[model samples]
Target: MKNKNVINYFKQVHADKVEYNKQMARLKELPSDYQVVYKEVQKFLWEFTAGDGMDMLPPMLELLDFFEEGAANNIPVLQLVGEDVGSFAENTLHEMQAKTRINELKRKMNERIAKKISKE
Candidate 1:
């Protein structure tokens, strides 16, 4: 029962992420004029959530930021961000650090559980 609950919870979380990814992909295909609105929204999001961590922008927002920068720099509006997008080095570094920390915690938890089982 507990395992089923955990599986269902993870499936729901994954489903939400998949939906968000689809939305982001669709947003990426818009014309330059429409992209500006999305870029503005991304900028506002960063400002609202920044809290002194400029390096810690969300991954999707980082992509949007890249697109906005390209637009500012005279890149064609219809070009895919990947072709025109600049580096996400800083954001990638921060995200990788965060992922490492999460993985470390998971490893520690598993070790602790194994030790407990051995003791039993």
Candidate 2:
């Protein structure tokens, strides 16, 4: 069952990747300024993936949160692309928040388990 859940998670991640690419293409159809920002974001993501240094998850989440807030508030560039882009940002933010919460929960659980083992 645990293995099945892992498999399903990977399958969902694959599907999300396909949709993410399509959305990125749509974003590229926006004005030049928006395209530039998108390209920078892509570069940041690539570097985050390729780098072999300390984890940058917190900063990456902060960046996403900034964009999400901008889109939700209808900031100029985000508004130019209309509601679809805003919605995408909102969804991404929610997903990231959920993942963060899950990670926190996992960390706590591991700590508790370790303490229990130490006491045994």
lDDT of 1 by residue, 1-120 (tens): 999999997896776677567757766665656476555545543442332333223455555565657665777644533332223333433443323434556788999999999999
Stretches off by above 4 angstroms in model 1 are: 27-57, 65-91, 95-97, 101-120
CA lDDT of each prediction against the hidden true structure: 0.54, 0.53
Give me the candidate number with maximum lDDT.
1
Model 2's number of clashes is: 0
Clashing pairs in 2: none
Q: List candidate 2 stretches off by more than 4 Å.
A: 41-120
lDDT of 1 at 24: 71
Question: Clashes per prediction?
Answer: 0, 0
Question: What is the TM-score of candidate 1?
Answer: 0.33
Reference-based lDDT, residue 1, model 2: 100
Prediction 1 global C-alpha lDDT:
0.54
Worst 10 residues of 1 by lDDT: 81-90
